[model samples]
Target: MSQHAVLDNNTHRDLRVRIEPNADLGDAIMSCVTVPAEFRQVQAHFPILFHKNQANGAFNAIALFGFENGENLFLEGGKWDALYRPLALSIQPFLIGRSADGDGPGQVHIDMDHARTGDANGVRLFDEGGQATPYLEDIASRLGLLDAGYRASEAFFAALRQHELLEPLTLEIELDDGAKRSLVGFHIIDEERLRALDAATLGELHEAGYLMPIFMALASLSHITELVARKNRREAHG
Candidate 1:
């Protein structure tokens, strides 16, 4: 349970949070989330996919880390397996929340009850003069980047939808129990359609700086092989 409060030095002095590097801190059921401007780095490890919120009909780009629900294969030995951890997962116990004043925009808030937060064993939040510590400053910077990245992605998402490059992906996998599972309804970049685009359209994407990230998203699809292999290995071990 999260009891988020606007982070303050006076109220949180002497507080220390033991950042868990190895543990899987992301949502257990839906391990995937939007990567925004971090797609270039995210694509190197996770498969980038286009997802639509059925309830709100919002389209966003996401980095897929596992095949089935609640199964993040990258999690092992009480830690994450990959070298590049997504920003969404790294900035734990902290998030962009609604401003208390309700005046301008969202502000940063921390889950006061998070397992990482305590009186000891983690980075300090503030100094004696009630100023942010170095650790806190770095966290603030990361959060800023994450917020800006998501905002910037809106335009890129629009370009993708306009060009009709997003297409649904379906997968057939046999689990360790000899049960065949069909992963469906998720979307991916349609490479064929992307390739078939005209020079003018290509120029537009290039001018808009959407070309590279699109290629990165396409490249990340290869990571699906790693997911399949992990599943096969799990079944064989069993």
Candidate 2:
């Protein structure tokens, strides 16, 4: 796809704002003069606040977007954070932006708490609290597992194994106490793949104890590909 088309495609799939790169930071600040109706709707639901300051004939604006009650994850929070964390840690001078003027530049900043306090330099895109949504927490709790750090797939697999789900070809996942229920598919790990994993890796999984099964299941299902890819990319560059 052409560059514009590719960007357009991504914009559709994700929540983003474009600002002119060349424009004075002040001009960029003013450019958000009108909040798009869709954004206003989002503002109504979540805390999307902007502060603009005038100095040296230039404007400095900081926009704070908050996710409340788990709704904003799709727009610009936890989901994006989960997807980008591994990649961000590897890349330096990493920033996301856009330009107000088409020919100018724009930027999107991913801010994370871990990035702050010198834990990491990049902007944090996800809230740690939101990372453990009740639905996911329930999944873990029922299976007697803990979060494998902030990685969702790892946490999921940990829950699975803790609950001894490996032998079951298929199982009923009760999402809630009500009538809601869904069937979860399962796959058996082949000996080749199992054997390929070294002792240290196996030990790490075992160390996770109840969490090990969940990570194994996630690995088998390929749910951790993005996280693993990001981790590999970071290692390559580091």
Candidate 3:
């Protein structure tokens, strides 16, 4: 359950949010939606994949954190091992909420029931002068980026589909002990198709600002080997 309320300095003056990396704060997911704007940074730390939304039939880019449900390999000892975390995960406990009429500008909404809220030693949301603290300001900025990125993602996915660049991905992993695990229901960029594109098509994609992210997503696949290594170490320790 969640209790959401529009953030106000007067009402939430003493509210402090714990910003540490922890699984209890709802970071235990195997993956989360990502955006093209984050692919450059996210690709360095996690594999970028595409997931088809069953309800909407839309494709969303995701940052893969684990191979199975309820697993996040990057999270260990209450700390995220990656050098960069995706904006979707970092902007937790706070979301941009539209007004009642739905035509007004977005407002910052905090989840009051979140584990990060009301921590005694957490970062303050407001200062003594009833002003938003630096922490809240940063969250607001990230929220803006996430909002804009989501909007831009539609064009990105359309470009991929128009060019038929997405392909199903099947991962068959063999652990050190000869145990096999298979992960399905994910899609990735088709490098062959990308390379086969004509100069005119490539130019169009470059002009539209989707080329870099495509390459970044391709580069991110290398990190899958690292994820397997992490899984091996964890199981060996156990």
Candidate 4:
């Protein structure tokens, strides 16, 4: 369970957190929720997919890291092997918290029980003068980016669904040893449908600032091939 509390310098002055990428720090994730605003960066490293929310019937964009659960191929030798790590993963053990009525600016909340928290040799969140450190400032900036991106993603997905651009994705992989794997219950943008969109509809999507992200998501599918290569390499070494 998570022990969440509003971050305060006076209450948690000596707190330090591990910021490195490692499985021990809960970095062994196969996928994470992403936003349309991050597609440009995320596309360069990972495959992007959409997942449907069964309860609300909404769609959430995701960045795929591995073929199996809890397998992050990008993590090796205590380092992330990518130029751009998703903002969602960079902000660890901390999340944006809203007020009781959920009608105000967000606050930074920390999960005290997380593996990244309470490390003796980790980065300090505040200075002796009770001012925020550079590390904490960076985290706050990332939290802002994530929160804004999350809100914008709603409209982006709404546009995709409105135009019927999403289609069920069926991905299958074969390893060097002849083992087979498959990804289920994920969706991808339908290129054919996108190409068939009328001029007026394309204009609508463009004006709404969602067209580039659509293409970015399509381009990101190429990274799936690279992920398979990484998996094969890991298996060979084992």
Candidate 5:
């Protein structure tokens, strides 16, 4: 269970958040959420794809960590090897809360049960004078970015659906030990359909700032091979 409360100086004066380096620190089950706003950066390191939420039938973009569940191949020696880290993972133990009006600016809330949160030792949430610390400010900023990025992604994903550009992907990967892995049930942009889009449609997507992310997502597919290699390395070293 999570104990979330709107962060304030009065209640959480002595609160401290530990920044741990363990791969399992974050809820990274081989895939982590990635917003369209960071697709350009996420693409360079991880393969970007869309996952379907079974309950709501909604799609969410994700940066894959490994071919199998609970396997984060990017983790080595308690460090992430990738050049880019997903914002979703970085904003740990903190989540954006809904406004009182159900819109406008969000409230910053913390998961008190998270292993990183405690009053003992770490970055303090507030100074003795009741002002936000640099650490808290940074968390708020990143949390805001994540909220905005998620909103922006809704329209971008809708555009992809409207143009019939999203396609199911199934990867057949071979391991270093001659074992084969089948990865399925994820979605990626269809390059052929994207190329076949009319010039007018392309212009509209470009004007809406969705073109760059689309291309970036398409480019990120190449990183699947890198994921395979990383898995193989883990298999060999473990």
Candidate 6:
């Protein structure tokens, strides 16, 4: 397969497959930022609805995973303060979309003040007029974005598997703006000992810098994958 095609497939497969515990932060972000049943439950409580842009024609949806207190935060919101508070911890956002899906319809603003009671378990959604609607459950049930996010992730992993770069490699690229950016994915095929890389190569990336987050993600994924494999083996033998 062509390099582009291979990479695309590999990305998709990677999405479907959970990240190994050894995966670095990037992988962890990808794996954990998925839309699952638990996340759906959370979304059911706090639903933020918005429209997406049109250029791409595919499914449109995004799933955000963060921390608010002890509970996990997942919702759709434009304003950072509304969805994330200063005290919140480990806040990360994931966007899911496609060309076919087109931009979302009208936007709906939810009022957190009235929606949030003393309960910290989940979020509550409000209507346009800032009124509580009994149909919250019904609205949550029909959220298509959550499912769309899962599908998008699967597609990304599949693309990666096709590339045969699943092992581990560092990606270094030079942007059009004359800036260099280095990102370490789950695979790291080559290692630079700082001294080996020429001054020119190093200089390009000096401003953009290398992202260590991807390494952390890969480590986390590797660990999770091992745990899952062990559990499966035990079950089979038992």
lDDT of each: 0.78, 0.28, 0.93, 0.94, 0.87, 0.29
TM-score ranking from best candidate downward = 4, 3, 5, 1, 6, 2
Cα lDDT tens digits, model 2, 120-210, are 3322323353243343233233222111122233343443344433332332322222333222222333335455666876676567553
On TM-score, the stronger of 3 and 5 is 3
Write model 4 residue lDDT over 96-148, tens digit each, in one string. Answer: 99988878899999999999999998999999998999999999999999999
What C-alpha lDDT does candidate 2 achieve relative to the native structure? 0.28
Which candidate number maximizes lDDT?
Answer: 4
lDDT of 5 by residue, 71-117 (tens): 88877888778777788888888999996677877999999988778
- Sort every candidate by lDDT, greatest first: 4, 3, 5, 1, 6, 2
TM-score for model 4? 0.98
lDDT of 3 by residue, 1-238 (tens): 9999999999999999899988887888999989999899999999999998889879999999998898999998889898988898898889989967767788999999999889998999999999888888999999999988998999999999999999999999999989887889999999999999999999999999999999999999999999999989878988
Best by TM-score: 4
Q: How accurate is candidate 1 locally (lDDT)?
A: 0.78
TM-score of 1: 0.87
For candidate 4, the lDDT comes to 0.94
lDDT string, candidate 1, 14-96, tens digits: 77877665443443533556555788889888888888889976678777766777776777666677887777777777888
Clash pairs, candidate 1, are: 17-122, 22-79
Residue 63 of candidate 2: its Cα lDDT? 17
Poorest 10 consecutive residues by lDDT, candidate 4? 151-160
For model 4, the stretches where C-alpha displacement exceeds 4 angstroms are none
Lowest lDDT block of 10, candidate 1? 22-31
Worst 10 residues of 2 by lDDT: 25-34
* Clash-forming residue pairs, model 4: none
